[model samples]
Target chain A: MSDTPMEAAPFAEKAPDAPVRVLSEGLASWLLVSPLAILLAIFLVIPISVIVTVSFWGYNEWDFYPDFTFENYEYLLTSAVTFDTYVKTFSYVLMAWAFTAAIGFAVAYFLAFHVRSTVWQVALFLVCTVPFWTSNIIRMISWIPFLGRNGLANEVLLQAGLIETPLEFLLFSDFAVVLAFVHLYTLFMVVPIFNSMMRIDRSLIEAARDNGASPFQILTNVILPLSKPGLMIGSIFVVTLVMGDFITVRFMSGSQSASVGRIIQNEIALLQYPAAAASAVVLLITVLIMIAVMLRLVDIRKEL
Target chain B: MDRTETKGVSRRALLKGTAAVGAAAVGSGVIGAPMIWAQNIKDVTLRQFGTGVSNLNEVAEKVKEDLGFTLQMTALDSDSVTQRAATQPKSFDIADIEYWICKKVWGAGNLQAMDVSRIENYDKIVGIFKSGKLTPESTIAQGTAPHSVGFVPEPGARAFADEQTNWMTLIPTIYNADTLGIRPDLIGRPINNWSELLNPEFKGKASILDISAIGIMDMAMVCESMGEIQYGDKGNMTQEEIDKTIAIFIEAKRAGQFRAFWKSFDESVNLMASGEVVIQSMWSPAITAVKSKGIPCVYQPLEEGYRSWGGGLGLSANLSGLELDAAYEYINWYLSGWVGGFLMRQGYYSAVPETSKLFMSENEWGYWFEGKEATEVITNPQGSPMAQVGEVRDGGSFEERMGRVACWNAVMDENKYMVRKWNEFIAA
Candidate 1:
């Protein structure tokens, strides 16, 4: 109550001057950020706007044309297939996010807290990214030799008398698809979280310990709250990537799986340009909504 | 990547090529006229784009050797080939593409009518591209028969004729009767009908191609054989027909009947070679490739017949004058024996059967065309033994296979709807 009265007294005195001060402050910051805004306008904004314009155009088998129509959007909304595809794509996002976040947090926690020497921590962290040096297609393909029908995993399982028949789900299955997603995107999650974790003050842990807080209690109460920003940033990277990916799912699932990107690709291949553009626009909006929700959950700008 | 094999007339060197040809024309007024034409032709280059099945570097080298002009080949997948053919006219001088794709590209007017009179072996070309029949008794099968679009009624005509004429759209190159390929040693049973592909017994041991335009045809064949859905025309399926066909496959896919769907030749080869799949919708050369690895693979003929697709060369609308003459020269040389014989060794039938027969040995002709047991081992164009001494070709004679073509790969009037349904199947 004492703090509220003091805050209200200062705010009441400064009310007349507040609007002018905030306007000038915002303008200065906006000027500082203008270059990046202009860059985005040229590359990202212009291309996406073009796609948006095309989304409302009419098309047939031969070609697309300049005419306003809502048929593409109507077709998408009415079809059960589109909704099912969205759900499947969402499932992929959830699976990838879960695996990537858990694995990324553990790895980053080990590097930031467990390792004593800074040089060794850097070396070990770099070692975690060794797989990134090769082509993604190569890395995904390399799984086939190990997870195939008569591959190493099956042969080992069979030799151990685990089962009579080989495991069919080892490759070209949902399991394989999710495995590849985690293998590819874990680094995306790890880096941001690691940066945030490294910037965390060490005295907080000491302070908790001196107050008779147990290690687990300290972890839950102190470290977890402080790491929210890193976790949020990492989750955003993983969620957007998994939601947009078609290649990893396509290759790993052997064309048996579907993504919104794959649908857009198939339409483009058949020269259904307007339909592809419409799907792209819808996907863009859906991803933006997801990011907005993530932002609302954690004030990322303030944390950064 | 494109390989340009030549006397070095690159894409930008066309003007120089015409100048060289003009110089040769002037030199042709001298004693050694044929020598001058041959020498100057080396400076001319023609760019050709097609599917990898036909646009071999070997064919380009052979053209350079025989026709005295450079032939640059760019190999792309079927859809990309169609896209380039329809939208990019100046990008290529010749398009070796499928007939169904021809329907799409023809409307764009990117290709011009090729003269049947210019192709020397035109009459000797197969009846399928001329009369729409392999023999007198042969009824033209369903789908876009090459003969339907092979000719135009007039010179520089953009529209395809219903019947044959002197003004041709494409000079036929290679075609085949495609069917399911099976690893016979793995199955240890005679699998004959198309219905066997989705049989519960082979559950998790079967696959189909993932290409929608072609894959749907195979699905229609399977659905008909299984007595699930009946279609009046498999190639140009109605909207209801497509729905039923896709639904049936989606059910089968959900039941785990498929090991994996293949999108490329190498993937099909890998599936068969690794013993991951026992039966699948397959291309001819993929079977040959598997057999070349000493694996027991067969392009098995089913009781329901085969789904066929054919590809040929179409001239770009941009060609005229001496460059056009050089292209005509290349087409004539293509129909001549050696290239046909080379392609025949790789499991594709030549357009001019009689000329190709001249290039093959008696044993090869008997084994490949006549379906006789091989007295000697048969080698592919790469000189690798594809079949052992006593083995007969899997689907029997060319007459036996070609006579039974059930349908051709197609792009229907309802192509957009069909593609949407196809995507729905994949998503399902």
Candidate 2:
């Protein structure tokens, strides 16, 4: 009777197989999402794979067919033009990033610490964001009227006897390009820093002040340390954006400043897609490495 | 007793169940095959350069109404258009290209052999558009029978009508010879020759297109008229010939003769409008815009004649499959009387001469179409003639412009070098 004790129970149930249930559930969910997955693989994955594969191929001028060759990548690595482009682009991005970050942090800091009312803070932030509503081209063109030889600035300056002749240096120059980049992208930097500042603990600043610290000390010790995540994020945005931009540089730099983007455009125009794709791949790899390094330093996961 | 037996079902049943599931999956794919196939219609996209002239919205609407097809248009520049056509053939269906850009694009095999038979209005096209011995067709295909239709002819602008038919690659859409656009109020004197532009009196007031192709050609014509042998063999010139032409531009730049080097049509118009420039090399559309603003601008015809280019339509390579019939229909409709008339009324001569008669008066047609002498001055919309009698811009039959064209600019080899050099020049 003890050996066959199971016979005593009339309606006893057996334990369910947990793995089978979980697997079945997973299968059902996957079945529901299979269409989207297939679509993504076809449209996104396949095209990107083709681009990456083709980037490795050499081009034939006669048939316009791609042949397998590492020459494109090798040329990019060894060419003086490509190297110079990279160096120039790096410097441009650095300059743009530094300028944007400094200005954005200052504005963000003022709003976060000095501004009291939430409504005014939001209103001021909205003012900064308003220009983002327009197309980049339109915004860039608007600068022409303000910076042209007979533009408002020149007219005013000339009328005020500040200059005898119209300023030719204002419009199609590096200064104008940087000015445009700063005008267009400063918001990208400010929004992130402002968000980060909003998340900073007010009590930390109060504690530093209460412990007989000055405003400078409180800012340097508490505020700056706390805002590193925002600063890094803003710098990354500004750098990546400026690096990839060609139109602004072309319009404002008066064709002298041929950035990497311009070179890619010129190559592509000549029907050199492989060369263009190789250059794009180089840009992508550089950006990825930068992002990886940034993530290692800032632990973006926590900030995000 | 039955529950234990049910729980212990045979493996054969499980095999049957899996087989049924696989069958269902295959069956669904088979049933859905047509839907996927239907979505695979050959879609063609085209890129056209420039903004005001092509007016893609208008073109798209007209195509949709006439041909019952969609033509996606992305407006870009001449350089960008050439680049896309050369690199990404699959990306565009048709390109609105300037006549000069045909060399590079055709040389690169980015263009397909245009089948003239497919186009209904092929027979009615002016004689200049027909292929001669040295056209793009001859260069690209090497003596293969000309297959493409040139809709835009730079009428009366041919440089080498004997050796090569410059009009074969580009069909004439809207063309006006480069006229000496002058402010009569400022100059206070009639300008009858190309030398008037370089007159020291107008120093720092004249402007020219920064592009090397048109500017250099214009200068070559000027030099030729001024008793200089800058252009060899009619208008056909070697690189040395072109270099001499560049010298004039360099001298002008040094002399501060040009108010500004204009890169765009709009910029040129702005220069004239703001009184920053008193005289300049100008296009037809810019003259129209300047006159529309109540400016006393006259397109003065110098003794050397006008330098010009033509723009027209082309078929996409991918158009052969899905929208072949529709594309043909659109092209035919575009060449018909209505569109031609519209273009003519807008001060642009059209490909079809019959359409020009619909909008223009008999006198206007006589002056424009038949190339007959005009009894009266050709006034602007504001009732001002472009120029006084002897100072008229090149006016003649479309065939004349297409036929007598001096040396068509060397766009493939020398043009690329010139464009790059121009960029360098701008940088300098």
In TM-score terms, which candidate is top? Answer: 1
Position B85, candidate 1: lDDT: 87
User: What lDDT tens digits, residue by residue, belong to model 1 across residues B1-428?
Assistant: 24564434575476655665664454333212243254456667899999999999999886665555788999998878877887789999999999989987787888989877767788889899999999999998988888888889997677888888889988899999999999999999998899999999889889999888899999989999999987888989999999889888889989999888888889999989999899999999999888878899989999999999888998999998778888887777778777888888888899987878878988888888889999898988788998789999988999999999999888788887888888888888
Segments in model 2 whose C-alpha atoms lie over 4 Å from true places: A1-49, A56-63, A69-91, A210-212, A254-256, A288-304, B1-176, B179-282, B296-307, B311-359, B366-406, B414-428
* TM-score evaluated only on chain B, model 1: 0.91
Per-residue accuracy of model 2 over B229-297 as CA lDDT, tens digit each = 545432334667655656665676666666566657887787788676788878777887887777878
Alpha-carbon deviation at B127 in model 1, angstroms:
0.7
**Deviation in Å, model 2, residue A296 alpha carbon:** 6.6
Cα lDDT of candidate 1 equals 0.86
DockQ each candidate and list the results.
Answer: 0.54, 0.10
**Ten contiguous residues with the weakest lDDT in model 1 chain B:** B27-36
| Cα TM-score per model | 0.90, 0.66
lDDT of 2 by residue, A141-199 (tens): 78877887778999999999999998766775667888889888999889888988999
